[model samples]
Target: MHIETQLAQHRVTGLRAQADAHRLSTEAKPPVELRTRVGWTLVELGLRLASAPGPAPAVA
Candidate 1:
């Protein structure tokens, strides 16, 4: 749980850095930053799936 919170904070920090860098430049975002963004999005998606409700019981 502590590690999870740290990871979430790191994701927030990374995204803010990317946004600030982009705002300062005309060129498109770097590939690494793009990949990082995708990775974080996937991580959040997986976490949501992990915490979701289980399936209903089957009929007899």
Candidate 2:
């Protein structure tokens, strides 16, 4: 193949890949509000676990 034809094919392939990536990203992501709420819930759970008392020491 000619160099110019090869370059054009490469450009087309790159553009198609970029379009696919953009479509997947937009379609697969959860809504921002839901994501934020879930993130905060996880943070709260982590904080609670961290602050909770440890188990009592085992007797010999």
Candidate 3:
């Protein structure tokens, strides 16, 4: 299955997937290394989500 379809089926997306965008961030950590990785993952996911089209409109 395609990624877009997979995302839809799994119900995983940046839009509804995360209740709070803030949740995606890495809380202040002793070292910056952890933050860097979290940031990268967020960015990667954001790009994929952005590229995907929104769900189809509900029929009347």
**Winning candidate number (lDDT):** 2
Candidate 2 TM-score to native: 0.50
Whole-model Cα lDDT per candidate?
A: 0.90, 0.97, 0.77
- Candidate 3: pairs in clash: none
Candidate 2 lDDT, 1-60, residue by residue in tens: 999999999999999999999999999997779888999999999999999999999999
Error of 3 at 55 (Å): 3.0
Q: Please give the clash total of every predicted structure, in order.
A: 0, 0, 0
Model 1 ranges off by over 4 Å: 1-32
lDDT of 3 by residue, 19-49 (tens): 4555555454355698899999999999999
- TM-scores of the models, in the order given: 0.41, 0.50, 0.37
Residue 30's lDDT in candidate 3: 52
Colliding pairs, model 1: none
Encode model 1's per-residue lDDT on 1-60: one tens digit a residue. Answer: 699999999999999999989787746645568888899999999999999999999999
Best to worst by lDDT, what's the order? 2, 1, 3
